[model samples]
Target chain A: MEKKDKIYEGKAKIAKLEVDESPNTAQKYGIMSIPTIVLFKDGESVWQGVGVQQKQTIEAELNKVAS
Target chain B: MSAQYKVVILGTGPAGLTAAIYLARASVVPIVFSGPQPGGQLSTTTEVGNYPGFVEDIQGPELMDRMRKQAERYGTKFIEEEITSVDFSKKPFSLKTSTQTVTADSVIIATGASAKWLGLDSEQKLRGKGVSACATCDGFFFKDKDVVVVGGGDTAMEEATFLTKFAKKVTIIARGSEGNLKASKFMEERAIKDSKISFIYSSEVIEVIGDNKVDSVKIKNNENGKEKVIKIDGLFIAIGHKPNTDFLGDQLELDKGYIKVKDNTKTSVPGIFTGGDVHDWRYRQAVTAAGFGCMAALDVERYLEGIF
Candidate 1:
């Protein structure tokens, strides 16, 4: 999360956690795979993408719900 | 108007990222969609031993991260979106993703393959915990422990045999009538000849029972319709795999379910190329997928040269 672009990181509500750190949260997300990011808009989940993604990719997805 | 790219690559597993790395380096500026499962089968994989180049071992997710970063360093654009539909019927192929419609001069299909699961709720809940699909990736974790490999096909026989290296005992749950297995004679005989392997015919893994990690599986005898639970350290589901090409409709040629390719990575459609497990069924190794990715990227470079 720290490595993300500064502007994107600044505006985003990010929660970076290990699978072991939050087993219950991981279960609720149905994270069959690790390193998945679920984006939320207006307190509702909008999108989720699994695996290693670039900072720009994360920013684009974050922008979709920034309003 | 939809955004247009010189090249659009789908799926971000070894194949997709590998291609991105090459294309980015060549200044193609390819746009890649990470798909629903970004890292493909490898992300869920705990450890990988056979990918080569690494004398020590590496975690699956870490390897994929390195691949993605390498591509990012070279100007490859990535989108963490899944493509819901594609239209290869005309030039500048139209792809409808979850967010926006995009067009590309060239498309690379590296969506890869997904392992088939027993679809049990417990099985889904404990995927990375103790139940796995690849014996090559997670077998070392259960060294000297008892494990069970479920299936009766060639893949099942292969997984069971591979599990024998680490597991003290490898129980094969052949879901068929007694003494009638689905694996080929060679694979079946190999498992039968291995001293560490045992067989339980006419049984299916009804449930993967465990608290945190997989502790055991509930097996149902297909003949008598009775279920029994056995203690084990790990459960390997070797039923089979289905290629992730359903989104393509029929715009491309397919062999069975996998995309068929001829002349290296070139698909039936000239401008569209493919690599990885989406077209390959013989070798599903990570190294092999990466090699295919390299090929697809080179082919894309050459195709772009001819066009632009």
Candidate 2:
């Protein structure tokens, strides 16, 4: 679904699953904010964060899920 | 000499760029490391007024863009990378960034401070929509609208007082009773005297509520387990700011989590100067940061004169 919804596929490392125009996906995930990034390794959320976070934070989270 | 610059300025905010402009014009050939957020705090802001030059006003990012271009025009070399560590113990200070390590004869610490937030999920969601950390920067957008400010310190008092000019009603959410307020006598008295300003003692903002924009805030009493929702048009977090000196690794002196400077921008160690929000706690304005940047540049030039 994110493959169809994502405007651009900048990096192929991680897939972006967004439900911007539709609120159903957000409601399902209890997401109430924009720029909320969630890391999923095996169809399950491993880590998540909100707001405009630093690159270090995102990289650390990605490393955690990857490990 | 294995390639050492005359000076290296950390950060790309108003202060860093201004220093670069002065340094480049003087032919000192300064290198600037623009940290994670290039253009710093100003990039997050929408409009910039009281910056002195632009009478018609300009966007915050736009103002920073012009400053960066001006610095570049003067031959200021820019690096969009983060400095992971710095070794200022010896001459020709070594800096390790995300990409490469560089050395500079003199180093200017222009890394600006960041505003503290409540770390609330809803608060994070509504940022730039109706929630802001700076009253002076975003209060104009809340004209004649009800707003709330968080914090019990002098910063909160100052923000609440400043918001009165634009907000119809300003509510201060202090963590404890009024007696627990950390504000000074004059600042507290100023807010207390303001007709538009009100207080909610022994309270904390638990959650922010809104769909498109902020329409209300949920606050909880510290003593009791009761929560109340108040309609609000805007929210300001006046909990103060933390300086960007983490990478210094206890090398430079810090006073209350901020880099301490004397005679404007001179740090405790010679040839190592600090400018912008990293040192200026009284007025964190862009203009003042630029002034500090100018001072740091001249100080570095004079310091380099004795070295080479």
The interface root-mean-square deviation of each model, in the order shown, is 6.8, 7.4
Tens-digit lDDT track of model 2 for B113-217:
988999999998888678888776667667688999999999899889888988999999999697778888889899999999999999999999998678999
On a 0 to 1 DockQ scale, where is model 1? 0.13
State the lDDT of candidate 1 residue by residue for A31-62, as single tens digits: 53445678877677787765455555777887
DockQ, per model, reads 0.13, 0.08
Instruction: Give model 1's docking category.
Output: incorrect
TM-score winner among the candidates?
Answer: 1
In candidate 2, stretches whose alpha carbon ends up further than 4 angstroms from where it belongs are A1-67, B1-3, B118-149, B152-172, B176-199, B205-236
* RMSD vs true structure, all candidates: 6.2, 7.0
Evaluate model 1: give its lDDT: 0.86
Residue pairs whose backbone atoms clash in candidate 1: none
Residues forming the 10-long window of minimal summed lDDT in candidate 1 chain B: B134-143
Supply candidate 2's per-residue lDDT for B130: 80
